[model samples]
Each structure stands twice: as C-alpha cells, then as structure tokens.
Target: MSNESNLQVTFSKHCNGLFKKASELCTLCGAYIALIVFSPSEKIVISQVPPQNSGPMQFIEANRSAKLRELNAMLTQINDALDIGKKRENELSDLRKKNETQFWWACPIEGMDRVQLQLLKKALLDLKKRIGQHANMVVSQGTPTQTFPFFVGNGSSSNMPIEH
Candidate 1:
C-alpha cells in the first residue's frame, strides 16, 4: 500500500482508540466528557457525554424558560403599580375638580346646625386675624401703600382718600 494510505490508517486507528479510552473513563468514573477531533482534511468530530436525561441544549432551554417566567412576573408587578398610580391620579383629579367647583366658604350654610355655625364663625375669626396679621407684616416691611378717593354715601361730592 501507499505511504499516504498507511498514514491515514494509522490516524484513523489512533482516533478510534482515543475515543474508546474516553468512553471507558466516563463509564468507570461516571464523569462527563467532551471530545473534539479535527482531521488534516478539514473534517471534524465532536462527542459529549452529558447527564443521564439532560444535555446542553435542554439545560439552556430550561434556563431560558425560567428567565422568561421571572421577567413575566416583574412585568405583572410593574403593570399593577401603574394601575394603582393611575387610580390615585384619577382620585386626585376628581378632588381637584371638586375643590375648583366649590370653595369651602361658598358651600351652602342654610343646613348648618348651631355647632357647625359656631365652628364656621371660629374659622372666619381665625381667618380674619390671620389677614390682619399679614397686613401688619406687609406694612412693617415698608411696602408702599396706595390711597383711593371715594364719595361718601351722603348726598355730597367729597373726595376722601382711604389709605390702604
């Protein structure tokens, strides 16, 4: 036979022997094994001994599914938070509209009992006191005061300058 043919036979025998030894090692030790061979003619061989019922592809798919489940759970939580935020925003908007439509002082006082009327009077008194205090503060700050001339209600053309 030709020298090239002999070399090819030798190479094939060595590759087989290597694979056999690897298989025996895995069987005896119950260890995982991966082997790769590249031939001079650009041929390739690959072998893997994975666990009994699982392979690399199965593990990857399982991990991918687990991640998907985790992401889905997070998405659900975010959506729920958004829903709650929207509900709170709607409630605030309604409250603002109610406040805009009717001020506290503008509400009907006809239905107020004596206690409610007293509370209202107290609130008004407090408000008046605060207003007076604010006015005094403004005056103390040396803000320029303006005066306006007005005619007295009595049938007389008199210009009375009221300083404010």
Candidate 2:
C-alpha cells in the first residue's frame, strides 16, 4: 500500500481504539461524554453517552427540593427552641411577680390596712411570749441572766416594746 493509504489506516485504527476506551470509561464511571473526530479524509465521527433519566434539570430540581426540606426542618427546630425560651421566660416572670407580691415581716408597714396591723400586733405578742419563755428556761437552768439594754425589766414584761 502507498504511504498515504497506510497513514489513513493507522489513523482509523487509533480513532476506533480511542472511541472504545472512551466508551469503557463512560460505562465504568457513569459519566457523560461527547466526542467528535475529523478524519484526514474530511469525514466526521461523533460519539456521545446519553444521560440517565430526564437530565441535569431534573437532578438539580430534586437536589433543590431536598435542600429546601432540610432548611424547613432547621427552621422548625429554631421555632420550637424559641417557643421553649419564651415559656421559660414567662415562668420566670410569674415567679418574680409572686415573690414581689408575697408579704414578709421585714417589709415596710406603711401601706398596711388596719386588719394587717392587728395581725402584726398579734404576731409580735406571740413572739414576745416565746422569747420570755426561752429566757425563763435559761434562768431556771442556772444560766446567769444577761441584761439587754432594750428590755425594761428582765424580759418578763408582756408589753415589751418592739424596736423597728
């Protein structure tokens, strides 16, 4: 054969081999391939691997939907956390209000009603009686009586004045 014909045959052989390798690679890796070859004789050869399913658009849409679902799940979790935080805040606020409204003996008596004042007087009298009892007990036990400057007569007075 002439040199030109031998070159054409060699070109055809190599081109066929390249196409086969490309086909093998595409099949093994599940890849898309588009190959175009122009022979010395001005002939065109085209090879393409068809994509699976609808195409890239379908894949992209599915991926987008998955991402949106994930984002919505995250948003729901955040909303639930915010609701829990609000509930906790409301509980703490209620506790604070209850503490602020509850009455204590040490609190200021300026805003007390007449009935409240009577209750306070009774409580103070009861406290004075208990203190006198305790003092008597201590004295009976042979413990020397300690004079407090605030007491008028050895802590035995029923009308012991209470100091604010």
Candidate 3:
C-alpha cells in the first residue's frame, strides 16, 4: 500500500520469504510442498516446490490419468475383498469350534505327526475313563464331585479332549 511503484520489489521479497519457509518445512519434516500465487496483473508471482518434488504440471498430469484412476479402483477392490475374507475366516473358525465341541473326534487335525496323534488319542481315552468314573460316583453319592481336567504332562492345554 505504501510503495505501489515498487511492485516488482514487493513480489520478489514475498517470493523469497515463501520459498524459504517452504524449504524449511521440507527439510525439517521431510514434507514436499508446492506454493503457487497469481497476482491481479496476470503475473504468476511465485511457484515453489521442494527440489525432490514434481512440478505442478507433472503432478496434475499424473493424478488425472485414466490408468491411475483404474489402479486406485483396483486397490480399493482388493482391500474390500481382503476384509470379506477375514470375516469369512472368523465365521469358519466359530463353526469349527462349535463342531469340535459336539464331536471331539471330528476336530480338524493338522500338522500332527503319528506320535502326537497317538498321544492325543491316549489323552482322550483317559479323559473318557475319568468322565465315566466321575459319573458313577455322582450316581452313587447323588451329587457331582470336582474333577480336574486330564493332563498328559504336555505343555499344551488343548491336549485334553474338547469338553462338551
């Protein structure tokens, strides 16, 4: 307002300050930014971007391409598909737990060698015998008694039969 004749000088000072701030931001925070200003006199007063950043024109062209839009759509679809898969996996896990509770023998057996299978079989048989003995005692006494779960000295809790 005070020095209208110094239009060029004013523009130069403002541009220098803006660029300095932009550079500081880029260096301190590792952020790349672009600042563009247009004056009323149809003059492009300032355009600043970090050295590593693309020009405004290049940024616009890359963002506006059809291939970029297509890739974004594909990535969104893949993320949605993965979410659905996770939900389905949770549902199947619940179903498996329910089925195992109903029929312990039909539980999914994976990554088990022959020795492990034999040990599990022995543990299940011991559990069955214990259940039968506890039931007989309950009938004779007409009251349930506390029975500890069958342990096979293995470090696994699920080594015991799936209790109904």
Candidate 4:
C-alpha cells in the first residue's frame, strides 16, 4: 500500500463552482481564505473558509460566528440610531406645531385688551407680504443687497452623490 492520493476537481463557469474549489482546498490544506468581489453596480460579494485540521475548524467557525455576531451588533446599533432620529423628528414636528400656535411674534401689543389673535395674524401676514414685495423690488432693481445664509431646519449635506 502507498500513501498516495490523486484528486481532480472541475468547476463550471459559475462563481459557485469556484467557491466550492476554494472550500475544498481549505478543507484539505487547513488554511483560511477571505474573498471579496464586486459587481459593476458597486455591490459587495464576500466569502470565507476556515482551517480544517489541527482543531482549527472550530476556531474558524468561531471566528465566522463572531463576525456574524459583530454584524448583527452593528445592525442593531444602526437600528437604534434610526429609531432615535425618528423620535427626534417626531418631537421636532410637535414642537413646530406648538410654536406655530403660540407665536410670540403674533402676540398683541402690551396692555391692549381689545387686540385679538386673529387681528395680530392678519397684521403679521401684511407685514410679511410687504417684506416680500420689498425684496422683489430690490432684486428686480439689481441692487447689490447682502443676504445671509440660513437653513430652515437641521439637515446635513453630503459630498458623495449616492446613486440610490
């Protein structure tokens, strides 16, 4: 008897066959491999194999399981952050409604009992219209007017243009 072995493995043109070959090599040689690929649309493809001999399979399995746990932990963290953001958004919307109803700018003049809230609202609308007209007049006249940069709410601008 001779301790000799001859093994032949063939693969189709598909990537799954390649994966099987890699897995076979890992199982026979007691090695580990981490593979990553990508499609044209920038999606990720990944694979991993653990050592097969010297009790390393358990270690590899553990490591792979650990990685899965890590991914789960990260997903949980992301979910928590999203939940917090949603809660904050709801709170902000509620605050806006409250603020709109209790607008100090629309309050009546001090010590004027006869002034009503509706009247104050009409006055503010008139003032806003006048301001808008003045701004349009200035812009139409091509006056060198200074305008301040302002944001209506807390929104972030990203430099990278995401495709989807």
lDDT of each: 0.66, 0.69, 0.69, 0.59
Could you tell me the TM-score of candidate 4? 0.35
Please list the residue runs of candidate 4 whose C-alpha ends up more than 4 Å from where it truly belongs after superposition: 1-23, 26-54, 104-164
Model 3 steric clash pairs: none
lDDT of 2: 0.69
Residue-level lDDT of model 1, residues 1-164, one tens digit each, is 35877877887898889888887676555578898988656688788865343465466667879999999999999999999999999999888668634433334577545654675687657556766776787789977544423221211233323222
RMSD of each: 15.7, 12.7, 15.8, 20.6
Q: What TM-score does structure 3 among the candidates reach?
A: 0.33
**lDDT per residue as tens, model 4, 62-111:** 78899999999999999999999999999998886676444433233562
> What's the TM-score of each model vs. the native?
0.36, 0.33, 0.33, 0.35
Over 4 Å off in model 3, which ranges? 1-107, 145-147, 155-164
- Candidate 2 lDDT, tens digit per residue, 1-164? 46889979998899989988887666555568888999887889888865444555467667879999999999999999999999999999887656535533333578656665676787768668867976887888977665442322212234334342
Clashing pairs in 1: none
Write one digit per residue (lDDT tens) for candidate 3, span 79-164. Answer: 99999999999999999888765544455567455665787788779878988988988999999577465565233444433334
Model 1: weakest 10-residue lDDT segment is 148-157
- Between 1 and 3, whose lDDT is larger? 3
**Model 4 worst lDDT window (10 residues):** 3-12
